[model samples]
Target: MTDLQIRATAAPAAPGTTARPGLLLLLVLTGQFMALLDVSIVNVAVPTIRTDLHASGAALQLVIAGYTIAYAVLLISGARLGARFGYSRLFQYGLVGFTAASLACGLAPNTGSLIGFRLLQGVGAALMVPQVMSLIQRTYTGAARARALGLYSAVIAGGMAIGQVLGGLLVSADLFGAGWRPVFLVNVPIGLALLAFSRRLLPVLPGDSSRRFDLVGLVVLAVALGLLVVPLVLGHELGWPVWAWVALAGSAAMFGLFGVVERRIAARGGQPLIPGRVLRAPGLVPAAGAIFLIMAGFAGFMFAFALHQQAGLGHSALRAGLLSGPVAVGFGLSSLHWQRLPQRLHLPLPMLALAVVAPAYLVFGVILRGGAEIGFGAEAVLTTAGLAAGCAYSPLFARALSRVDPADAADGSGVVVTVIQVGQVVGVALLGTVFLGEVSFPAPARTSGHALLVTSAAIALAFAAAAAFALRTRRAAG
Candidate 1:
């Protein structure tokens, strides 16, 4: 065997009884939901946060982007850490940190403190989120694994929509007159409960002593991602500053350096953070590309639409959040049920669904351009788009990971999850720019309508590109 082979043995389950798959899944998935939910939940509460903390635009942007960037930059390292330490051990550590960060965010006295806490929250999520997928990949096999992935995908898609809805509710409810703090504080109790149950439910696995940490790879990758993501996120907000441009330009070179360093590590018979074999797995690259494109479009749509509803249409926070209900329901239903279809249809489904998504966005744009409120027509269109998105997204995770070797599960999960977080950051940065540039705060309805239409066109183009990649994925798989 090559020295690069990935191998590890899992210790027995907790003291008395074996971990029940269903309960175990619930425990881990809830952690996944919280981690992912924090990404978008803050969107609905941003205005309130701005008012409450007297935050500047840059600070506000950091509050949202910092978490995602930190989460993305450290994912591969976190996965490697999970393998070096135990998955269960890292998960508990991450949960404790995330929950404590949540409390600090809720109580933060200023924008600076909030941004710092948010970064810590992202770090916690980075450590926790990868373990969820690694756990799923390591624990289950056959149909059970498939079902677990389906639920996992549902949580993945549902979290963004649910965050908006739940955030709006929490903020609007103004529980105990705490205003925007509830959104962060709500995680406190749930995190504590999950930590309690996790001790008993998760399997205690042994660390892989054979594998060594690639500190150079981790630092290079983190710097590369920071250069890429920071500029993409902060560039427009800073009016395309020279540093942003320079950072964007430098990121390409840094990524090239990262590749060279990884290859050197691999050539020396060391395990690089991201194994070359994982990236070369058949169908994995195209599937990841499709995932990145679709997620970018989906996240962009959510961010842009939230702005349109509140800033453009003058909707209440609750109503704006409630507007996303159809999407959440549709995504949840489609993601959970896609596997029921016949075997032959599975490979082509993503391409077909993505094709549907492109036109769905255009149609949704047309409806809004007509100056219609989010009536039944708009709701139907949104739900259809959500259903298509679910169909496109759920299967791709399985498709990409299926091509990966079982031993590379943690590395593969890290790569895919990192792609997802980066996609969201890019989507918000680019598409949000399109929306913001076209419409300003408290603008005329007509202006807002036009801005949304333009933004939707951009989103449709992204989905169209995703469809092309999905087609490639189908061909590659076939």
Candidate 2:
């Protein structure tokens, strides 16, 4: 190991370190909570942003897609960068960047500027998020690690719920007459507070001084994803021009080139951006497929539901946020039981849960069609969907990483996260477009809600097919 690696690996804990781990975990979790919360918190604010910026529907889509694309593309590079420059240093820098970017986003006077700022904010988030898992792995061991993972998982689920609630409150509060700007600005105080705490709380991890930056791999991957995703997101809105198809075709060729380059790098004894062996793992294919399908369904539902509740139901942002709470609660409740289910069941619990979740969405579709008023009944169905999603997600992730070597953990995580992010883009593009097209012919007031319901049903059917395939593959392998 190089001197930096030695320093990173051999960094000493503070004297009598009992309280420090707990304190560090808390600080880390706080930052992570903010990062995860921002993902969905903005959903409820989409309409507000649209109106405020005088944005087209396509512009609004770019606001969300821009962040996710940047986030996904940067994740692997961020991990490698942290390993070279030091995790603590990168994390602190990321925190500052994220806070600054949030401010920029809040203060952006136009749609274009807002989208640019959001992309920058995503880069900061990508830098910070990978460190959370890496730090956990490095800091905690054995039962402590397990407990930390459990806590981390719980916090993640809780944060998703809190985002909606907080988004609602912030948008409705219109603090300082900033309107939706407060939603972005809210991160500043929390981020600054975390920065203060991190100085004392985070243990310095050693860096690999000899680690060479994979500039070629990074450029190739970024270009490939950008070519692929940017077009998908923009193409539908632009009426699918021939250039979109050309871009899509170019993306496939870029991906192929990326693979070949990575292989060459690995053969030459360098660390490639992504290790091909990890991707070739036996169970990874199905796991990835399942992840893609599940996230596609989930993202599409959220996008459509946000529009339905606000535009269709004539509800305020706060009411839309409140209506979404049951989904969060359901996810939390189901997640708590994840560890216990596999112990009692002979089958892969994730596959089983996914199987159940498809039906839950179908039932939700029925509920929507039945015209149940938005009260307890709507809440119950949403909660049920959340529970089913929670149960399905935890196990799917566990299965994906079950056989991965520790050395490749970060890479594996990055790959899965990137795939999910891409899935989200596709989901919004395809499902959202379908819904929009369907509703175009309908009367103004009645269209959005009905379109949303149909989109939900479509997603449910896709999830069912995916779940069935996963279960069958597992059985065949056995």
Work out the TM-score per prediction: 0.94, 0.91
Error of 1 at 434 (Å): 1.2
Encode model 2's per-residue lDDT on 362-441: one tens digit a residue: 67666665334476766777787788777766555555554555666667767766666677777876777767766652
Off by over 4 Å in 2: 1-19, 156-161, 370-372, 440-445, 472-478
Screening candidate 1 with a backbone cut-off below 3 angstroms (N, C-alpha, C), the clashing residue pairs are none
Q: What is the lDDT of residue 426 in candidate 2?
A: 74
- Local distance difference test, candidate 2: 0.74
Residue-level error in angstroms, candidate 1, position 50: 1.9
Clashes of each: 0, 1
Residue 475's lDDT in candidate 2: 35
- Model 1, residue 53: C-alpha shift (Å): 2.0
lDDT score, candidate 2, position 170: 88
